[model samples]
Target: MNPAEPLPRAGYADVRIIAASPDIARRVADVLRRCFDSTEQRSYPAGHDGGTRLQLTVDTAHPAGPARSWLAASQPQRADRPQGSEA
Candidate 1:
């Protein structure tokens, strides 16, 4: 399979494993976490539920070595206007 290939799962937006190594995966994850700060339930609806709900995978099995990076399939959900409704 190619790096451009999609993951083997259902109901996902986009998923891809780019790195190849636990160290690299950790590095990448750190970078992503820093970059994608506020991507968790704690930062969500202010004591409501979840946040940037995304799913990712880090592979750890290869001839060369363990795989790194993550593949995720997710979709974002935002609220709309509540007309003629109680708050």
Candidate 2:
């Protein structure tokens, strides 16, 4: 699919991941697959860079686990005290 084209709405997203190798690109896609329902990855050459590009569609509405949990897990906790509470 053309990268310039607009993707469909309603939880559907067009994901394009570029990496130095096909295995790296597919590895990234695999991580997404573990979180969301997605289509098979389509591989392509990334211009003169000789890198690999992977494209796929993912349905965010149907996440494999509780939505936003991953986001929370990735957040960094404050190093300071708990605010108004004892350290």
Indicate which candidate wins on TM-score: 2
Question: What would the per-residue lDDT of candidate 2 be over residues 35-71, giving only the tens digit for each residue?
Answer: 8899888999998888998999989777777445875
Query: What are the per-residue Cα lDDT tens digits for candidate 1 across 1-61?
Result: 4798766443322322234334454455555444332222111121233213223432222
Q: Each model's RMSD to truth, in Å?
A: 18.1, 6.0
Q: Tell me the whole-model lDDT of each prediction, alpha carbons only.
A: 0.34, 0.85
Cand. 1 Cα-lDDT: 0.34
Clashes of 2: 0
Cα displacement (Å) at residue 56, model 1:
2.9
